[model samples]
Target: MKIDIIKKYNDVRTATIDFCSHLQIEDFSIQVVQFASPAKWHLAHTTWFFETFILKNYVKDYKEFDADFNFLFNSYYNSFGDRILQTNRGNMSRPSIDNVFAYRRYVDAKMQDFLERITDEEVIDLVILGLNHEQQHQELLITDVKYMLGHNPIFPEYHKDFNLIKDQNTITNTVKIQSGIYQIGHQADGFCYDNELGVHKVYVDDFEVNNHLVTNGDYLEFMESGAYSDFNLWLDEGWSWVNKNDIKAPMYWHQVDGEWHNYTLAGLQKVDNDAILSHINFFEANAFAAWKGMRLPTEFEWEIASKELNWGERWEWTNSAYLPYPNFETANGAVGEYNGKFMSNKMVLRGASVATSKNHSRATYRNFFNPTERWQFTGIRLAK
Candidate 1:
C-alpha cells in the first residue's frame, strides 16, 4: 500500500512539472488579473502545501526550504500564518523561476524520504489530501496560464497542438430524470474533499437536462438576439454585471469581421459553432438558460442525472449555492480551511473539464467560484 501511494505521489508531482514543460522561461511569471495567479507561484505554492502540512507534521527534523516561503507561498489559511495578498502574487518576481524549481526539488526529496517509511494512517491521509490539493492547483495552473496568454495582445500560443476544447457534434436530445429521493454526497472509500463528505438524502423533482453540453451555435443564437442588452432575461445582479463589464460574449471570445474567434491554447482560432461552449460563468449560464425558457439544474439533479450524461468537457454550472451538507464539519487546523470556510458567496459547478488532471474528478466533486469569475473552464447545461 505504501509503495503504491509513494509512486502515485511521485507521478502526480512530476506531472505538474510536465504540465508546464512547453512554457518559455519568460511565461512563468505572468499574472494579468487579480484572480489569476502567476505560474511560478502555483509551482511553489503546491510544493509549500506538502512542506507545511506533511513534512512538518510527520517528520521530526524536517526543515523548510526557505523560512520566508511560509509567508510568500501560503494561500488563504489565516490560521496557518501570514500570507501575501492575493492581488500581489504577480509581484513575487524575486523568487526567480529557478529558485521555485529548487524549492520543489527540495520538498519533493524530503517527501520521498518520509513516504518511504511512514505508516501512520493520519499522516497518509494528509499526504493524500496534499496530492489532491496539488491536483487542484494543476487545473488552476492551466487556467491561469491561459488567462495570461489569452490576454496578451499578440495572443501567443502556449503550444502549437495543445487543444483544451473538445469538439463534439450538437445534440439537442434531452434526458429525463424521474423524481425520487436520492442519496447524495461522496460514498466511495477513496479520497474526496471535505465538502463531499456528508452522505445525505435529497428530494429532487423530475426534470430534463441536455444529453450533451450547450454548443457555441446554441449560444450564438442567444447572442445574435441581443440578449446581452435584455434585462428581463437575466437576474437583477447578473444584469448589473453584464452592464458594468460590458460583457457581450464569453471570456476570450473576439469578434472579427462578423465572425467569432476565441483564444485557445493553440492561439486564436475561429469558433466552431458545433463545438461545446466553455469559459462561461454561473451568471451567464443562468441567463442563457432563462433565454431558452429553461433553468440550470440544482447540484443534486446534476449528480443524479450524471450517471448517464456525457460530461467532462466542461465544469457545468449548477443553480445551487455552495453550502454545508447536513452534519458537515471541518478538520481541527489550517487544513479545515480547505473547502468549508469559503462556502458563502459562491456557486456550485459539477463535472470535470478538459484541463482537469487525470483521475482527479468524480461525480460529487464540488467546484465553486464567484458568479463573475469566468477564467476557469466552465460551461452551461440547460434543464427544464
Candidate 2:
C-alpha cells in the first residue's frame, strides 16, 4: 500500500511535466485571456500548492525556492498570502519559463523525500488532495494551451502528430426518464469535492435527455438557422453577451473560404461535423437548446438519466444553477474556499471531458462556470 501510494503520487506529478512537453517556452507565458493563467503560472502554482500545504506545513527543515514566489504563485489563498493579479499574469515575464521549471524540480525532489518518510494518515490525505488538485490543473493546462494557440493570428497546433479524431458514434436521440424522487450528491465512500457531499433526495420531473452530445453537424443547423442573431432565442444576459462579443461559432472555430474549420491540439483541421460540439459556454449551450425547442437538463435529471447513456467525452452544461446541497458545510480555513465561495451566480456542468484525466469524475461530480466562460472542453446535450 505504501509503495503504490507513492507510485500513484509520482505518476500524477510526472503527468504535469509531460503536459508541457509539446510547448515551447514562449508558449508557456501567454495567458490569452484573464480566466486562463500562463502555462508557467500553472506549473509554478501547482508546485507551490505542495510546498506550502504539505512540505512547509510538515517539513521542519524545508526552505522555499524563492521567498517572493509565495506572492507570485499564490492563487486565491488570501488567508495564506497575497496573490498576483489575474489580469497581470501574462504580463510578468521575469519568472522566466526556466525558473518555473527549476521550481517544479525543487518541489518534486522535496516531495519525493517527504513521501519516502511519510507515515501519518493526515499527511497522506493532504498529499492525495494535492494530487487531485494537480489533476484538475492538468485539464486546465491542456484547455488553456488550446486557447493560446487557437487564438493566434495564424492558428497553430499544440502537437505536430497527435491530432485527435474524437470518436462519436452513439445514437443521437433522447431517452425518456420517468418522473421520480432521486438521490443526488456523492455518498462519501470515495473522494469527492466538498460541494458534492450532503447527498439528499430531490424530486425530478419526467424529462428526456439526448443520448449523445450535440454534434458539430447538429449545431451547424442551428447556426444556419440564424441562431446567433436571434435575440428571442437567448436569455437576456445571453443575448447581451452574443451581441457584445459577436459570437458566431464555438471557440477555436473559423469559417475558412466558406467551409467550417476548427483548431485542434493536433493543429487546424476541417470541422468534423460528426465530432461532438465542444468549447462552448453555458450561454451558448442554453441558446442552442432554446433554438431547438428543447431545454437543458437539470443536474438531477442528468444524474438520473445518464446511467444507461454514454458520456465523459465532453462536460455537458446543465440548466441547474450552482448552489449548496442539503446540510452543506464549508470546511474551515483555506479548504473552505475550495467549493463554497463560488456557489452562487454560476451554472453547473455534468460529466467529464476528453481533457479530463481518467478517474477524475464521478456520477455526482459537479463542475461549474460563469455563463460566459468557455475555455474548458464544454458541449451541449439537450433535454425537455
Q: What root-mean-square deviation over C-alphas does model 1 reach?
A: 1.1
lDDT of 1 by residue, 1-384 (tens): 899889999999999999899999988987788999999999999999999988887789887899999899999999887889999999877889999999999998998899889899988988999999999999999999999999999999999888687577455678999998999999988999999988999998889998888889999999999999999998899999999999999999998898899999999999988888989888899999999999999999999998988888899999999999999999888988898999999999999999999999999999999988899999898899
> Model 1 scores what on Cα lDDT?
0.91
> What would the per-residue lDDT of candidate 2 be over residues 1-384, giving only the tens digit for each residue?
579678988899888888798788789889888988889988988899999999888999889899999888888887787878988889889788898889988998998888899999877878888888999999999888888888887877777765543657478667998888888888757578888888899898778888988889998998999999999999999989999998999887888899998888888889998988888998899989988889999998988887866888889899999999989999887878778999889999999988887679888989999999988889888888
Task: In angstroms, give how far residue 233 of model 1 lies from its true place.
Answer: 0.4
Against the correct fold, how does model 2 do in TM-score?
0.97
Model 1 poorest 10 in a row by lDDT: 163-172
Go through the candidates in order and give the C-alpha RMSD of each one to the true structure: 1.1, 1.4
Q: lDDT per model, in order? A: 0.91, 0.87
TM-score of each: 0.98, 0.97
